[model samples]
Target: MLRRARIGLALGGGAARGWAHIGVLQTLTEAGLAPDIVAGTSIGAVAGGCYVAGKLPELEEFALSLTKRRVFGFLDFNFNGSGLITGKRLCGELDDHLRPVQIENLERKFVAVATEYGTGHEIWLSKGRLVSAMHASYALPGIFSPVNINGRWLMDGALVNPIPVSVCRALGAQVVIAVNLNRDIFGRGTIVPDHEATDEGPQGLEDLARARSSR
Candidate 1:
């Protein structure tokens, strides 16, 4: 009997940069690389969830249809909470794409990571509602409100594990391939020295003591 090694794909978080994941997944498909398990954090959850649910093309269509005004259309601003956007419209779109499906029912294993708000701990969502997990994983603190699941507040997984390679290992993957989108983002930017860069404060022992005490 021949057995195949279980391969896991790890997706990283990077706001709008996460869009590149669609191309990555499409390329992987064209190359005949099918992962047994998928683990993702933050925006990675959205992409991975779509892939696991076999709705990648639909998600790609939605992404391709976005414009500046159309992007803003998803924002339902509310000043009552930490985040400015309600995120209801965006959630509705995700629900339209991946709802009515359970993680347990998926053909392959999928994991979405989120950060426990106050505890600053990693929360791995591997079962239950798929869309809920995706929503929780990418809910940025100051942009979109944190999601409350089982009485615990969860924000973006980027706060903890942006690329969940360890999560893939824990899930019994024999091989893990991680994609990080936060690389080389600053390469094209110039670092111009500002006047504040030369300022050094609290040189003396007394001033240093005062500064330390203020904290």
Candidate 2:
């Protein structure tokens, strides 16, 4: 009898970096376990493409150089009046989750919060500030705010907290948090954490290979 099987794999950290996509493809080629279908989120799409098409020798170097140049150019602008915070929460199969509580303790300012799920629930918050106060809050860790990237508000991290509801709705995920804010790119972007899952990475590769072989 023939059986149908499936597996899930997750890769994070520097390994998920843009240039590293080529490396992942090369490794898969060497192992003879090339993926039949490749799908990814955010920058992972770039890597997934390289894996299927085979690596170009200078691709990784070029990608890295471009990223650095873009970042540096944005930094030169010296705009410091924006701030953001991101949080993620895990709501395990809950229904009608409340959206984040938005508190307005001061005029023309607000605080937003929400939950996210990957391996678990995550929460994010973003705080926006007036232009004059921007510089004083630079490099404030654990917060997501607009970073000047290539002369644009990249919306890198700080936007995460305000958009969880939209992300959940779009992705059809259960609403583990309340608040019906318009989900934007904030909580919808890439997240990189250092915890390793039990069946990810090489073990995942091996399992895929085994399943393919059995089929």
Candidate 3:
């Protein structure tokens, strides 16, 4: 018997740009290039997690239904944590879509990356509660609140591994296809120079996205 090369997909972190991952997955499926293992960071975690849960279509519908008003309506602002939004409403909506899925039971290998708040260590979530893992991975400092698990506060994995290509390899992938939505922003001729630097960075994902769209 011959062995099939396991294909791994590394989904990058880019907040709203992560929505493009849905299209990427759809295209891959149509081209008969589906991944055997999937790894993601930040919003990539959300999309990849939902895809692994077999509820990606529902997730797409939820995304499509979002309007400015509706998106604002999801805000549950607070000052208790590192971010403005408490993440309760956001997690609630996500839980509605991925209520009972656990990482340990998934048919395909899945990984979600988060960063330890104080140490900046990369946390690879491959077990336990799936929704919580997704939230921890999606939690962005100064935007969405940090998630605590086992006495450690965790935030977006973009601080460390935005593309998580190493994670895909760690999972025993024979081949890796990484989708980096941050390409345009990080690529040459894209980012603003040091002269245009601002002390106040983007307060939220929307602000960063708007800046990207403008340029």
Candidate 4:
């Protein structure tokens, strides 16, 4: 008399619109569908990490409070011209909520994806430093600073595997459920890959979120 296993739960990134994860997770909870392997990119990484770490409630609260002002508070908004998202303020906020909960100590098995810009390799994070991995996964190239953990510069995981079904499948998760919050945000003659010249501004991102939410 043993229960079955659910393979994967994929979360998508959508900046401020990541709040939709709250709703989706709520439904999943009601349905009693707990995924064994979880994966996500960008803000989606935040959702997946917090969920696997048993801190979804706090993450939901944090996502709900992401007003324009509050979101800006977690940026590298310095007049001295600093790195993009060089601020640890965002991670600090996550720590404040998910304190006492480490990534490896979670109850569920989790996976996070990060892309190596130098080698074009996809770094799948199923183990090792949790907080650092979360920070690297969410650090949107030009929007946030790159994470140099032990000399490895890592940015957003979505740069490569936005929908990490393959990663989850690789980790032995045969059944995958992917929740994409960043559908249609880019890759259509918009938001060029070059960070500095791209046009995924706050307004544009918010608009994308709203549009997705409506649909």
Candidate 5:
């Protein structure tokens, strides 16, 4: 469906760009699917701000730079900690799951997808290992860090976290879809199922083995 949408936009002279974090918002608006109320998680807040402020033209570049800074912060923090940073994989997975759930469970949960920035999700999740562990065990990637007194994660675009403006007033904020980007690189050591051994990150038979062992 996304591919089709992208193709349709491209065919119709619409600019279709792929973004890791803020791109989701860009694509939505570019495709003329803007939400009535906008809420962003972590770096996504920048995109939200752009949308609300009528700064669509600058959103793409802003998001790119913001994400670059975020990745840099992840790298910087990784050296001092467990040497694992960058919430790309985790955030990517959460975005995948939340896309469907948001439409389905919008009334019950305020789904927000966050990414790593200056402080990295590792440091954030460290504050609540139990919650982090729960997310990890369920394969639901997310940084289990609670927002500060203001209920916000610090990142680029500005220091203070901004409250999301709802496109629809009826749906109140209830759930946040957090994306955690912290963990040791298990490398080829991790296993997969129903496949031969290979130099891949927990693929094939090894992946299944790890899943079973976790059980």
Candidate 6:
């Protein structure tokens, strides 16, 4: 009997900075690596959803063709003043891309994380409408609109756990490979040129996310 390779993929969140995921995923596939399980947060869900839907190549194309505007659309203010992001466009995109695609129908197990804003609890949904789970995963507070799932309000998973490689491990993946796209390799914060004309790097988004969770 041929032994099967148990592989798991963990994806990270990064607002509009998920283009790297497309490249990384393509590289892994080209190298003959197949994941038996997938885990993701925020933009990672978009990429993960495509993979689960068996549309990796299409996802690559989508990432390459992905514009800053389209990615930023998730952060734009909607007709509803409370949420900075309007769910219509984001949900529409999910519907258009992952049509007729079910998570349970995927070649591999899929998991996406979401956080309940009320209690700041992590809700990992392994079974449900793939796109709906993804929508909740990418719901970045103050950026993307909150998603209502089963009467629970959820925001981006990154706010709670940006990396959930352990989730895949717990699910029985023999080998785990996680991709983190939110990392600023150089640790260089954003610089602002004020009247002083000097570089002033403000806090990173992750820090802001932490602040929000505390409140």
In model 1, what are the clashing residue pairs, if there are any? none
In candidate 6, what are the lDDT values of residues 1-215, reduced to their tens digit? 98886888988888767768888888888998988888887788778878778776876776577578867754446766546666667677667777566666677888787777777777675665787788888887876678776556777888776866766787888898888876622111121110010112322434545665698
Q: How close is candidate 4 to the true structure, as a TM-score?
A: 0.77
In model 4, what are the clashing residue pairs, if there are any?
84-144, 84-145, 85-144
Per-residue CA lDDT of model 5 for 1-215, tens digit only, reads 33321110100000112134355545665786635334333334323333444444555554456565554553322333322443434334334323222122232222122222343321111112121211222221222222221122322111121222221122332332221122211111111111211112322333545677999
Model 3, residue 42: distance off in Å is: 0.4
Q: How many clashes does each candidate structure show, in the order listed? A: 0, 32, 0, 3, 17, 0
* lDDT: worst 10-residue window of model 4: 189-198
CA lDDT scores, all candidates in order: 0.79, 0.28, 0.78, 0.67, 0.28, 0.70
TM-score of model 6 (CA atoms): 0.77
Candidate number that wins on lDDT, 1 or 5: 1
Judge candidate 3 against the unseen true structure and give its global Cα lDDT, from 0 to 1. 0.78
Candidate 5 residues lying further than 4 Å off, grouped into runs, are 1-34, 42-46, 63-70, 78-147, 151-215
The TM-score of candidate 5 is: 0.27
Model 2 — which ten-residue stretch has the worst lDDT? 87-96
Using all chains and alpha carbons, the TM-scores for the candidates as numbered come to 0.83, 0.29, 0.83, 0.77, 0.27, 0.77
Tell me the lDDT of candidate 6.
0.70
Question: Which regions of candidate 4 deviate over 4 angstroms?
Answer: 1-5, 78-82, 184-215
lDDT of 2 by residue, 1-215 (tens): 86322211111112124355566556756876533233222233223322323333444654656666554443332234333332111111000121221111122111122112222222212222211111111222333343231122222222333222332233233322222212333334433211111111222323533665698
Total clashes in model 5, counting residue pairs 3 or more apart in sequence or in different chains: 17
Error of 5 at 146 (Å): 5.7
- Give the range where candidate 6 is weakest over 10 consecutive residues by summed lDDT: 189-198
